[model samples]
Target: MSTAPLSAPRPSPPMPRRTGRLFALTGAVVGVIYGYDTGSISGALVFLSKDFDLTETEKGLVNSILVFGSILGALIGGKLADALGRRAAMLIVACSYAVFVALSAVAPNVEVLDAVRFLLGVAIGISIVAAPLYVAESTPARIRGASVAAYQVATVVGIVLTYFVNWGLSGGGHWRWMLGLSAIPAALVVIPLLRLPDTPRWYVLKGRTERAVEVMAATDPDADPHAEVAAVRAALTEESGGSVRSLLRKPYARAAVFVVGLGFFCQITGINAVTYYSPQIFEEMGFTGNGQNFLLPSFVELASLVAAVLAILIIDRLGRRVVLLTGIGTMAVMLAVLTVVFSAGKLHGATTWVGFAAILLFTAAFNFGFGSLIWVYASEAFPAQLRSTGASVMLTADLVANLVIAQFFPSLMAKAGAAATFAGLGVLALCALAFAAVTAPETKGRQLEEIQDYWSNGGRWPTAPEPGPVGAGPLGGSAASPASPS
Candidate 1:
């Protein structure tokens, strides 16, 4: 009896290394816009309060309105990314930044400044969703973690750059110049994006097979375009029934919960509370004066940049779970230290430096884990069809948590004291450590398609044998073609 021909396994296609790097660099530019805006506000608020005669409540509102706007942006960003395409969505974000950043520089009143900043937040919301997704989709699995981390690297660089700008201008209080410098970088992002194409997976999802193949060829010359395209199509077929709500159902729900929880906890752990109010926090610790306040926080941001670089170097090697657990644990310890220092009443001499050291170490730990990995996790955690939507949901949670911290942190500190406030954040850090240990998966070296398959296989990592060539039987199983692009 003649046996039917047996199917053979094919090796995974090589990633588009050069093209992936280019896309990653482009995402970094998007990150620069995000970082500059986030950091600029921290210093600008100092001069802004004086210029506007602001109260603590008003300061909180000014700081938080941008985060609130980001919430609105995150809500819409997913749909925009899906409907308009990631490249187009990011282009819109870049243009919006140029306009709003310029407007922020020229605002005649705090109301107008707040309104402009809110609009800028919308752009930020969309870029954060689209940029990392753009890089994650374009990059090869081997270096995908590092490539995505590049966005975080640029983000830290932007923050550090802004801090220096704030310091230079703090001498003269050139808050307008500080906010406006970002417009230059915003305009710069548009140039590279104009030349790039949407991700290959996105093209496949849209059923533009020819374009997808072209992108695959350009990005990964070593890749088998036909094989990769078929794999994507097979993966898309598996996700044909997916929607925003589907993320709350079986398989996908675990990922959604992990990602959303990550987003929420990353913020509530007090990274932004430090980023937004570090100068003020230091001032409260008795390091007063405009130049002196921004000067110390600049070092804090520098430490964060160094930690982000370290994450880029080791994220893939150590895996997401290891890095996250280490970082969160360190953060909890540092926060506990800060609680003790703050409880000693206003810091002086060695105690003051000790408080500074704790803050610096806390931020470094934060950047190493949560800041660097959050985007990588958000971008890679969902099926191709739901990638943007999932990222949006995570970002929305992040911004909402950030809003609470920004809006109520000062009041909380006043009412409960700095020690109590930090103790609360410390508690949250411990909770995050447990949550990450229990829920966060090791995604290093896995292809995005394999990750989706993990979810489809009921919470277990997919270990089924690789199938015959694409269209033979899904990559690992059978499913229908993806739904028509929305």
Candidate 2:
């Protein structure tokens, strides 16, 4: 492939400026499907239980089966993305999402539905890992946090939108429609996936530097394509093969611990408990009316979404450590307050309002920090070579935590009541906060390759490392620009 002359004065035509935003927006469809799948199920569960006469164990099974499938998806999907490329893996996920979800909608019995949900689970799992990885690879470091967090924002959009869908379908066993409607967005996302280019990073990895440069120029015209291409080549040169064994060693192993911890805590923060079964939670809080149950949780999720938007705006400025610590601290406090309020016994009037406010605060705080940060952190943590596989390691941890919680939460509620369940989670939240304080690094404006050095140092970088070949330019590393031809 011909290279751009290093000192050439030739003017290159500008690519469309809107490319980055459009790509990020398209990638967020994965988040929408994730939100819809998770958020919609809670509402549907209420009606589904009635239809199937499901026992508590069966109910938990139904809720957790998707997560179980997700675990498998993340494990395999990460490798799939690395091997087949991000765009292709996403295509597979999108098609699977449309097919399985549609199958789920028409399932004739609980056994059929559960089996289908598990299949659908695989698609959702892959979508979550591949989408953020794509967005991270495609955007510049300056806005990487916000761009990837766009997935989380899209998740909130899905959750908030699905709440309304649930409300509309809440009548007399229309749960099938709620479960199936998700395919529309899945189909919509597939349209863009069909047209989108594979990430430049992936292109570079495949030694298709010419194509990589083309993608970069289109995405960010201001970038010096030759410098960016050289940086990517250098980074790839330093990297080893992305074998699973490699990821399990020394620096990568230690990094995996941090990623896994973050993923595990992200789920155990009680966010899912509220999101997945908010109606039931409201009922426990003494709001037995259907409107209060559904409407309040929807509003809570809206608050959560708004908080995520705020995170996106300030994440680049505040840095990951500060924002993450502050958010976790706030969440821990709020969860404690929730435990206290709920423990004060089920009540009416002002107390109920207090409970609602507490729930809102907890949800908001979680979305502010962990919701967006988890994806940002996970997507950026690994070296480029193992990016997708490393993401799977963490994502698998997340889904494992999710599966266990989903399967046992209802029984935990039945056994110990909501207050105790929340109190325990609050304790876990404090532990998460402690973990962040001890190990989290500042990765606000660093290139993806540069960020890996943090883990290389065992998560203690008292000062920033020197700029390396991966992003050694005025604009910093292989940025959004494409390479110019010689």
Candidate 3:
């Protein structure tokens, strides 16, 4: 009895490497939204304060309340990502961003603006968790650093783009447009994502093996789909659960210490302080004439983008620990020099130039190492099951530190003066350096599954795969359609 003649074998559809590219590109829109949100305010505040007649404390609250909102979004979004899915969480974030940004634009008073900005922060926080996690999970291990670094590159682009936007809007009382324009891009990012699927890792965890295999085929065509499925299944089986509580155990707990420290220090070391207040800082350094205050930081963020590109080139080669240490060391030294320069209280001539140059150097150094690696490392430091939760926990520390720095920076500059304020930040850089030296492991060239084993094995490097076909790495060529799995 020919059982209806076993259906002729189905052919495996062509697996386009574009899947990986699309993954990074789509994830980066969130970064653009994030960058624009944070950077636009730096310029908008110039007008916002004037119109509202805001006090320094009021200014600080407006800048910092977004961070407070992000803290809540991160914690809740983490659970949502794990419980529902990454794709869903990101969709919610995008819609929220568009709606809240429009609301923020229309607010008539400082109190109303503050409330809307805080709600907007919730969207930023959720995107922070969703974007990096999606990039890390969706790409192959080999190109993971570059893929995540793309997010940083997009951030710098968004920041730089806002500089121009802020400039165009500067001549008019158009700060509202600067704040509201983000809705356009937020809506744009959503359109492409509608066609995208939840990550294969999430599918595997949910026991949707068929769907996982389909996604894996598209993303990493050379890898055996069944092997990929089995690996995720096995990894999940070895774990007790995928909750935040699970992350507080054994090897994961140790990794958490490192990640949390990285997150907290990443902010407290004054990166965001410099970014959010570059114009004010430049003005204080006597670069205010001729619109140089805004122009110079626009140039600096351009340099930051270049540094991010350099990081993508070198991170996998030099390794995370080496790059991070180098970055922290350079930033600390630059901050120290600025401390000395500001202490001299020189407002013009060579001294002013020296302080200005130091800010440029610090901005470049940060994006080169710590800025690029922080998210990449945080995303990789946890196991598959705990990645989203771990990233959330890490980012929560980051935002808390961000809130403290943003809220207190003006007051600190007032109370301690610029020299002492930067001096405190410079010292935090030393602390970050020490933490990396002690706890940060080299994560280059390892699979996500392999990284968990590496951490469990007392921080040993995982066995490296032998070099394979050209373009076989994560960012490689399209695959020829093969016979479907029998």
- Using all chains and alpha carbons, the TM-scores for the candidates as numbered come to 0.92, 0.91, 0.91
Which segments of candidate 3 are over 4 A away from where they belong?
1-17, 462-486
| Clash number for candidate 3 | 0
Local accuracy of candidate 2 as per-residue lDDT tens digits, 317-400? 988877788889999998888888878886688988888898898988888899989999888987778888888888888888
Candidate 1 lDDT, 1-486, residue by residue in tens: 322225532433344446767788888988977899998988888898899999887888888989989999998998888888889998999999999999999989999998998999898988889888888888778788998988998998888888889888988888899889989888888998887888998888877776777777767777788888888877787675546897897668888998999999989999988888878888888888656778888888889889999999999898887788889999999999999999898689998989899999999999899988899999889878888889999999999999989988888988999999999999999999998888887889987877775555554564445545544433345333332211
Better of 1 and 3 by TM-score: 1
Candidate 2's displacement at residue 127, Å, is 1.0
The superposed Cα distance between candidate 3 and the true structure at residue 324, in angstroms, equals 1.3
Location of the lowest summed lDDT over 10 successive residues in candidate 3: 477-486
Give the alpha-carbon lDDT of every model.
0.85, 0.82, 0.83
Question: Model 2 clash tally?
Answer: 5
Best-fitting candidate, measured by TM-score? 1
Clashes of each: 1, 5, 0
**Native-vs-model 1 lDDT?**
0.85
**Span of 10 residues, lowest total lDDT, candidate 1:** 477-486
Candidate 3 TM-score, true structure as reference: 0.91
